[model samples]
Every structure is written in C-alpha cells, then in structure tokens.
Target: MTDTLETQPLDRAPATPEDLFAFLDAHGIRTTTVSHPPLFTVEDSKALRGELPGGHCKNLFLKDKKNRLWLVVALEDTAVDLKTLDRRIGSARLSFGRPELLWETLGVRPGAVTPFSVLNDREHLVTVVLERAMTAHELLNYHPLINDRTTAIRSADLLRFLRATGHEPEIVDLGPPSGS
Candidate 1:
C-alpha cells in the first residue's frame, strides 16, 4: 500500500480542481469535494474563496529546538501566535519549518501543505495539531499534495487521517486574536 502511494504520481494531471478528489476516490476514499483556484498562502486563498462550499483551513509546518517537526492545521482566518502556541504545545522552540521538510515528510512542497499529505508519512515523525474551534465546522478544505488544486473533506475524515498517521495531535482553542 505504501509503495502504491509513493510511486503513484499525478504530475501530468489536468488543471481542474477535481484532481484531488479523483485521487482520493481511486484510493477508496469517500468525502465531499470542493474546487477552487490555485493558492500559495492563506491570504492568496482570498480571491478563490467566496464561492467555496466548505470550511477554510490553514496548514502550517513548524519545527522545535530539538528539530522535531509539526504540522498544524487551523481555520483560515485564525491568528496564530508562535509564542502562545509553543507554550500550549510544550515545544521548546516553535518556528516555521523549511520547504524541504514539507516535501520530505508529506511529499509536498511549500504551497501545497495539507494534512492529507500524511498519506506519505511512512516514518511518521511529524506531529499533527489542530485548533479546537475548527471542529464546529462540517467540512474543511485543504491542499492535496499538489498546490495547483484543493480538496474538501469531512471534518471527521480529517481527524481520522491524523489518527491513522499514529500521531496524537495537540489540540487547542486559543481564545482569539489578542488585539483588533
């Protein structure tokens, strides 16, 4: 199964947003799908948002002093303070990871960060985190290994994917942004 996933490449896939959905379905995954324009960051997602049919998500990759890495996914507009997040997560030093690790662990590059990339985490070293508040939403949208597209899946399946990775995520609900 791991080999199947690793060797499978959709590099020449069509430019349509459904590429992610088709990839999931071919693997027997059943989740709702939403399409949107290609995005590089949460802010870049704005223009492609409005018509989106599900919850917006932000995928972050961080590293601690010990060189331990983490992937934190939260609501799109959520304001994340690394200082507070480090304290809450017990990470001695939490800083954004470089693009290389994103590819090493998740088989994805910088702009394509997403929890779904856990599919390629054979070593299972990267930690997963989620802001508690996003659970209130029914579904969430995220990249599917390739940045040229996006995917929408049930909130439960997102959680399931995290668990299936054999890593217990550090979940939190940071009240809100400190200032307006």
Candidate 2:
C-alpha cells in the first residue's frame, strides 16, 4: 500500500508583499506602510526611519538541536541571548538558522525576516515567539516580506494575523538583557 503522507502534494507558492497586503485587507486588518532605502540592520533602520512611531522589531530565525524551527519577534533594542532563551522556550540548544533554511522555510532573505513572512510558511513549520514586552506597545512595525519598506499594525491585529495564518504565537517575557 502507498503511504498517504508521502503522496500529498507540496504547498502552494509563497505569498508576495502585495499578496500579504491583500490578505490583510481581506481580513479587515488595517496597516500602514512606508517605503525607504533598504535596511539590513536595526541600526540602519533607526537612522533612516524619520519619525515613525511604533515598537520597531527585529526577527530571528532559529533552529534547535532537534531540528525544530522558531521565529522570534522582539523589539529592536531587546537583547535576545540564545543561551538563556533556549531554556525558556523549552528547546534544545538554539542557533541561527542558515540563509538557505530561512529562504526555504520563510521565503525571505536574511535581511527581510518578519512575522509577516510566516505567510509563506503554509506547512506551519516554524513556531512563532513574540516578546511579551514588545506586545505591550499599541503598534508594531516590521518589514513587509522585504527590506525596502516598513509596515505598522496594531498589536492585537498582529496576533490576529498570526492566528489567521494558523500560528498561535507563544508570548514570552524575555526579561532584561543579561547583566543589565
């Protein structure tokens, strides 16, 4: 007999930034986006993002020893020590996922990792982790599947979007940076 799982078809093509926006609109999730020079780091973003107000964020794509994947979304200034985070997240030792793995799973490059990228993970392979403090902000800003723009959405709307995409994110209080 043939294995039913093995015979299943692959996931559909990944969603583009436009597609993501459309999805949000269809769900009645309001958002605002600003275009600017491509930003590859938090420092770059801070320097160029004039007066945008919100809890700007940084995303980490990680892989644990057991090969499980995680997407961590936190405030740009938050210090995420994988050494301690691994324990709190209940995972084996965690390390940065490779560029290829990031692309394969999230359909985005290193500089464009965002909670929005989870739109591309149709198979639900990554567990999303939201920093508790970050969620306290009224609004959150992130790249919209690309590095050349930033999008702002409500904190409640972010949770709404993630759940809409089949991801019930884990909200964790990743307390102060070590030795702060």
Candidate with best TM-score: 2
Clashing pairs in 1: none
- lDDT of every predicted structure (CA atoms): 0.70, 0.89
Q: Estimate, for each residue in 1-180, the C-alpha lDDT of model 2 and write its tens digit.
A: 122322334356567899999999999999999999999999999999999999999999998887788999999888999999998888889999888778777888999999999998887888999999999999999999999999999999999999999999999988874356
Candidate 2 TM-score, C-alpha based: 0.92
Candidate 1 lDDT, 53-111, residue by residue in tens = 77788888888777777888888878888887888777767888776656655667788
Give the residue spans of candidate 1 off by over 4 A: 1-29, 34-36, 177-180
Worst 10 residues of 2 by lDDT: 1-10
lDDT for residue 72 in candidate 2, whole number 0-100: 93
Reference-based lDDT, residue 70, model 1 = 82
